[model samples]
Target chain A: MSSPKAKVLLVGMGGVGSVAAYSLEYGGKAEVTAVLRSDYQTLIDDGFEFESVDHGKVNCFRPTNITKSVEEAMEKYGPFDYAIFSLKNIPDISPIEPLIAKCYTPEVGILLLQNGIGIEKPIFKLFPEAYVMSGVTMVSSTLYGRKVVHVATEHVRVGAYDNGKIPYEKQVAKCKKFIEIYSTDKNDIIYDENVNFSRWRKLVYNACVNSSAALTDCDIGRLEVFGAMDPIVRPAMREILAIAKSDGVDLPEDVIEFMIRSDDGEWYPPSMLVDMRKGNYCEYQVILGNALDIAKENGVPAPVLSCMYHLLHVVQMKTQEKKGKFVLPEVRPLPADNFQIKYLN
Target chain B: MSSPKAKVLLVGMGGVGSVAAYSLEYGGKAEVTAVLRSDYQTLIDDGFEFESVDHGKVNCFRPTNITKSVEEAMEKYGPFDYAIFSLKNIPDISPIEPLIAKCYTPEVGILLLQNGIGIEKPIFKLFPEAYVMSGVTMVSSTLYGRKVVHVATEHVRVGAYDNGKIPYEKQVAKCKKFIEIYSTDKNDIIYDENVNFSRWRKLVYNACVNSSAALTDCDIGRLEVFGAMDPIVRPAMREILAIAKSDGVDLPEDVIEFMIRSDDGEWYPPSMLVDMRKGNYCEYQVILGNALDIAKENGVPAPVLSCMYHLLHVVQMKTQEKKGKFVLPEVRPLPADNFQIKYLN
Candidate 1:
């Protein structure tokens, strides 16, 4: 029997979302419906550019079904088989809830592609009737103008939310088919028994790596090479693990090790670091805020994480206050005079 | 009557020491003697090279009066007018204490040219007879092989230690005559009542700018353009100021402003950052360690400084350990396959 056609709706045509849409389209598993904040006329006239680290360039001319508003998207392509939500956690989720409630279909599964742990539960609560799943993508992609560049090919782990029973067999099949196009391991699609554990595992990885990288302004691989595994990663991991246990999610040691000892360990500059570097205040509330909430809820003390959260918060606040007012400070210019040194001196 | 020709012994033939020696020699104010760790043979074979930042190259050869031992230096150039010391702080000062005791002459003065604050008192305790003074050099110079390359035409600040009451007027006058050759009036050569305060001021500047630059792995000029100044410099300045105040050193507000405001008010990378890029652990102990010590001693709370110290220490220690063993862990290399978009995508 021929497989049925699947309709996929990708929200927020940012780096990861756009790449995943291309992966789905190129994999020939589904028809992608992209919801972007940019003008539809511009997208139609200019089109989107696709570039990757592995596969140099793959430009598509196919007329993309794009919309700026969820209402417009629902009106054009309703009842999507999968709604891939990769929106940033800023501006809070309240603004997006009404739209999700209006657009979500019973058959559609919401796949959350974001950093940090526990953002999916609130989304799930908003759409209790909808199939909710959480995904952790290790791939690195960035949006450049109208182009989406896939910088690195890493893994993506998707599982049921709250370890709820894997959606119907058909849903599982559709999810796997969608993931297979972009991810190397077709079998890496794990139906994790505890999605929170998986999420926490990823969070632990991010909490240790991202904050340190952002604060130190070093790359991820450089951080580990500098022995972050001991003083930084381990200390952070212990606190996250404590928080996870209080939430009744148990992260495996092997999993933590796997996160730290990845084959190609380099500075994986997190999106937050990118934002900070660009002078944009990231959604620290979503990433670190959730961690802090868990810590408070579980009565676990996360000293390092707490410190990082405060630092990021202060950074965000200061950046906001000084936005548009930032002018480069005048510094002493490099000496114009050049001196040649002969060994005899 | 005219002062007797000032006889100068410079310990540590690194960049700063060599440049200072060159300045003294070029000014024709004092007779110079360099006591390097390397033997006299190497000094004679490869004469010290001086590359000026403003002026072109100048090669001058003094007699090969170098030695591997401090005792030897004392025997050859001791009971002299002044002894200038600038050495690394690692391996502690114990190794140099005996050397200092043997070489220190009551008639001779000692001027320390090391970075950071608070190294004079211990030396004073070690050699009560000799006049101990402190100086801060602003000139940027680096040693390439046996040659010293001066990168900037900056000034130097010299002052007497502990209120200029060392009871060695002849020696102080001799030292002043030697420094007058290079330092312009733009940078004061005044003897402050508390040289430690001057040292503390310079230390505060270094701790804020240098550590952040080193940690971020960027040049000083990049910090402002990169928006790193707000996140890295602001908090570090607050902490350093707190520590300085607690140590009974009241740093002027204008000095702090001078540090934050770019020379013309533009971004500039300090030398420590340059050292980090070169993979050298330069001045961390002097910058961060001194602040840490002051904080601990004076009961000042410096969370930001503490965090930076810990982070820098880890990087330095790990780098050192890796160097000692010569076994580096495999890290993820930069993604050569991908292109980063410089602007918004």
Candidate 2:
């Protein structure tokens, strides 16, 4: 018998989600369905365009199962074998709780292609019977007008949440099939023993490099070349590592080096920096909020990251106030007196 | 005899020197001898123009004692009672060493209005017989064409070198008279017990505030509002404090607060930022070089400051190559281990 075609549903078709959907469809290993906030009529009338750095423009007219609401998505693409959750970390998880309850099944798996550490536990609590897998994408993508532009092509790694203890064989299989669809290289998928370390590794990269790049308003490539990177980047990374260690996550020194050196000496602009450039809200909460929360719980010192988060939160708050929408990410308060400021007066 | 007229020679007819010269003349404190390099012939021919942010423009001609060389300056304005050294920290000390040796008499007190710390020590070594004093000017002056514009009415603090062992009472009196001639308020000159602390304070400010601002290419006023300031600025301040402590300079905690909480609470752009904006070679050595040296001597880790210095040095080196001047600032090498890239994979 022929291998079964995996059914994948992508919620929130932003830059990342759009790219993942296109990748899944282009690779032809899965039947991809994209659920977007915009009306299906608009996207149907004007087909989606995909542009990538590695691959040229590929436009085709296929039945792009698009819907505005999750309910409509569930009705149209119900019992999805795998759901790719790549939404912004805003509006909380309350709105999605009911949807997850309705669509979640014992056999179906959920893969989170979002930033931040420990987003799976809350969802797991909401749907204890369903399997949840965590993953991080190094691919850099952005939405330029209606077209999705992939700036950087990196690999994707997904693993069973919490070390795959609760019968995640089907979920693992689904994730592997989805990875094959999304990635040009099949070896990119790494089913980790504990996905928390992988999540923390990516989080550390974003917390230090992304936050600094956003704050400085410089491209990542130029920022690394500039002198400000070390003083700004290292302390923030160290703080994130401290918080992770306290939370029982052991991040290897080599992992930190890999994250820093992974840029291939080329300046890759992080999502936060790109958002800041566009005058939009960033996922500061995903990167910094998690670290700050862990720092508070573990009682680790994180003065530099705390200050950065505070300033970024203030900026995000101002941006949200102007936008009149809760599209911006949330930031957690940092522990008090984690670090002291010394003056020469 | 008319208090010997207090003959004063000012080297470098830059914006700051021109303003100081004007202040000294208007204050009737001394006989102001303004010396300029070959490029400032226009200012000598066409009278000096002074403009204030609060007040309007005022024009005056003092027939500046312009000279092509320092030897000529000494010949024309010899046996000077005070010499204001306010040149860019380039061309090394070799150019000025002989001139100071020849012209620096026991009565001639050298006032260093340059950025950074430990500059006076080199001068002290070069001219042991002459007295050296260090001072910091909070005044903001810039040159627009032939006009010297004062953006803020900030005060200056002057102190004798080595805890006032050199009988600076006469020199202070001379400075007071010069301030009056330059139309500066009498309250601007501050004499303290230890001027070295003030120098250290300024160094800390430069290392943290200036270097970051330059690297980010943001104005001080804008940097305060920029989200990156906290991450980029605070650690730089901490690293500088660490280096200072290692160098045996005790900076009070309050000074750091004061630096952050300026009277205006707006970002205060350092001269380094201005230099970066203008695409001029910065005085990186005078600012970060000294701190790096002290940090090395004290065996303290100063990765941030060292990185900033190195980046600035590279920029300077590149500029020098383009200009074919070979005028790069001297910086102390950083600790090998501390200088290694931790995050850059």
Candidate 3:
């Protein structure tokens, strides 16, 4: 019956991730499996809930299977047709492979429903024959234990990463097939001819508003209303655009205005701000580090990004220390006999 | 015989202000009168204490006079030779005149024993006939109630802000006269021929290290031992230098290194950080805002400084809100009846 409905697996289910899983199951063309590691017990006991404008108060996400880990999911339902990664693309924290290796199969289309650039390269390098696709999403939402409250619009633009191992025509065909299953009238999924264009353009928002909101306690809405948008947001967007141009991507000039004027002046607490508030590790490596590396390679100066990067790095380090994942260096012992009290002595 | 021991009145008695008062009295050239508004009762009851290496656990500074306000002090001890404005030079918080007008007679030297560039402009604008001298100090100390725990070195550089209304020779004499009264062997006070040069050089440290440590929760010791010095500190220093060069002030390169490796890896919680922690208004206006204005006027692109300035402004705004000093704007309302849910519809 329709080739077993194209079995799919989903991991890293945050607010955005949960939306993807819910949307896929709602489309009714795939059997969805979600791996709930941190909140597996809470999720199973309470189930998933969403107060979405699209789905109108969805009480639960009925994925075909739920497991603690991907290996467990693979053992229950192996060789899935598509495995979607919805986690933050921080490879240092969560490695791509070993987690998805057991469920790996040739011709399995890999979709990255996450933020940041250069996420597809790692997957393609690991699973050479698998068709790699990258998806950029803008959903104003936050995730808690087994629940998501999406406030504004949820739009996704996805495109294939051009795996030369698979023929171009075949890759395009498979991309369209995934879209058929993933898209609903509400989900509003579209195919980007050049996803890099979509990505660098998104960076205009991510690298500027997201980072500023995270660093300062100001949200996007407050920042826009207040006087910070011109000083912090616009200049940072210009820097991102410069870096993107260096990498051969020309984002529009009004992309800045488009990013700022969100639907209905909603106070969007960006994902990084939420993550920092929750003491969870943020997504700086993909969002800023990758772009900074590109800037460095091309000899473009991104002072604003560099400043935010270093500050955010310190924040991440502090977060890691709080989690007992990393230890901060000891404060060097002060010299005793040097006697620096000029007036005191 | 000693010409009535110069009557010098001091307002804004925090740790640095207290130290300046104590040193001026200790030097025995002037009878120091201190204005203590918030801590007047405590200071009068408990007096002042300094656990100093130079003075050796000094208890109670013997200023010639101490009062609750400048008017009170002027009423009791009028027509003072010098009125040192050691408070944060924040005129917005505390207006200059009326507070000092009663005590202000011609030839009363106004020494700004505070941080910032272009602080003298306002002073000259208001009181053109008075000699305006700026003193930049680096003191490791903190004030609590009426007590001060002096930790490390305290060095001050004093120079005249060239009042063309007065003869150059007369201004130089007034500067040296105040320095004589303000310096003990321990005070380590030096006179800078070009105070703007000193102010710009000092900004090389203030604009970078102090602001960064305040923005991030790191101290100078930790920032040095950690890896933030290169990313946040040096680049900001370079920009400040570039702006200074644009305005015809050339600061040396080694100032960055010298500012970081303080006496024996000592932990210096910058004043702004301490101020933020204490829920007090910070000095971004003088420290960053003024410098950024200069950068803009000179057409020098100080992206790092501008970025820090904006973020710090937001932080200052939040601080103001917490203190009930400023009211933030309300979040804009969303649309009432726009039905745009594509997938669900």
Candidate 4:
């Protein structure tokens, strides 16, 4: 009997997602459907105007199928082989359950292509019986206007989340096939056995570079110009490494050094900084706050990381307030004398 | 001779300097000659268009003398009784030695009415024989246009910077007279024995409120709205207090809490943020960097303060870059793919 054709439902066609969707379609391996909101009409009507070093220009990227909502996507093309979710991991903005419940099935494996750790936990909780996995990418992509996505890097790593019951071979097979479907001549995709470690490793970079850029209004290479590495990024990275160690993940000793040296010549405004520029809330809580909580749970002191986390939190909330989603509490201006100057007149 | 009317040459008549100049003239206790730079033409031509809560509106403040340069001030009115300096403490902008060298003498006292720590060190080094005193104020004053200074608070604390050889009573006496000369019925001026401790105490506030506002682009009261008190301000204050304690100052334990709670109602943007808005360099190094260095010197950990310090440093450098004074080091953007991602075919 011929094998059933694999069907994929991808949500959130942002910078990262658009690239992934393009890569998936380029391989001509799976029936790809995209679920997009906000830009759904534009993308559906005009398709994505894509630019990348790998692919000179993809003027139009209309997926095989597109829908605004998950319910519609499922209604039109349901019981998919894989459901891919790619959105920012910021909190208090949107709910994820309805989308997951409508698209997810016992046989449908969920793949989260997002930055940060613990993003898949709530998904796993909602659908404990469903197959769930996560992927991390080092690709630099930004969605400009509503239709164009600029891409610079094109490397991705995917692995099935530790469901405790899923065997290694079975998980590897699932992830390998997913990687094959997404990998293109222009894009390189890999399947990693140690996905948790890979996520943690990426967190080390995100927790520092993303927060620093957003907070400083600086691009990555400007960090060196400002000498932020020794005082800001490196210290935060060390704290993050310690937090990882406390989580029983022993990252390499030179990981911090490697991270710094790697960025010695490059300049990229991380997605979080891009979000800040767009007046959108950042994934500070997921990327930084989660690491801090884990550090606290493991009795590790992450003062540097904690500092950046708090600063970034303020920045994010301020951004939200600017966007009119968050309203700041107004208070009376304090009487000047109440600030307390010791008087000995 | 009525003490030769106590000739005083006040330089850099910005907000703090303007208020001090007005106070000295209002007291009718000294011959206040202001050696203004940019505002000198304005003062010499139209005089200071002043406004204050303490004194409703002093239409014009034509000091006994106003000159454009230290050389001009010294050549015009030299060997003053007190060389009062009130300038923002930013580095690489201007030099203070020439001013001190020109205006100061053996009998002249140096009273620096500024918002920072370690500002008086170089002055002391240059004029070891000059009686140097430092003062801290809770006054909120800003220079509007080129002539007007609006003041909100009017309390000033002056203490003689301990010169080691100067007796406590002698230092206090000098500071007391300086305060008396600058004190008006509209302004409350007091002499303190522990000026260094007082500077550290003020640093606690500036290092927290000023840098927080400057970095977050939020006012002091807005910190509470963003919950920056618990996470950002209080932690930084605690670290600053620790540094003070390490320096044998022993600031009050409730200082941090008091600073936070005191700001519960008010929402004034600190001067550093104001400086940022003006596209001027902030006093970050003097306010936060000195505190951090002292903490490091005393072997005390100041992670929170260090975070703010680094953030403020970047902000200050960015401000300088904005003003076209400080040029950032240029580097070529990294070739994108060099991040080294392994591919599985």
Per-prediction share of native contacts kept: 0.24, 0.03, 0.58, 0.59
- Please give the distance, in angstroms, between residue B345's alpha carbon in candidate 1 and its true position after superposition: 51
Task: Give a tens-digit lDDT track for model 3, residues B9-54.
Answer: 9998887888888777777788888888887877887788887655
Put down candidate 4 lDDT per residue, A1-345, tens digits, no spaces.
655557999998888888888778777787788998788889867888888766778888888899988999899999798999887666545656667899877778789888777777777677765677789888777788665555566898888886666675676677788887788788878887777799999887889988888887887776756668888898889888898888878899788777766655556677777777877788888899888989889899988788888877777667766767644435544544343212222
Worst 10 residues of 1 chain B by lDDT: B336-345
Give one digit per residue, the lDDT tens place, for model 2 in A127-214: 7656787878776777665777777774577886743456567566665665565665422445565678778888888888787777
Ranking by DockQ: 4, 3, 1, 2
DockQ of each two-chain model? 0.17, 0.10, 0.40, 0.41
Q: Write the residue-wise lDDT of candidate 3 on A180-221 in tens digits.
A: 888987878888769889999988888888888888777776
In model 2, state the lDDT of residue A138. Answer: 71
Stretch of 10 with least lDDT, candidate 2 chain A: A328-337
lDDT of 3 at A256: 82
Chain B alone, TM-score of each model? 0.79, 0.82, 0.90, 0.90
Worst 10 residues of 4 chain A by lDDT: A336-345
Regions of model 4 farther than 4 Å from truth: A1-4, A146-153, A165-170, A329-345, B1-4, B146-153, B166-171, B326-330, B333-345
Worst 10-residue stretch by lDDT in candidate 3 chain B?
B336-345
| Per-residue lDDT of candidate 2, residues B121-202 (tens digit) | 7776665545665768777788777777887763667766652445567655655544443344532666655777777887
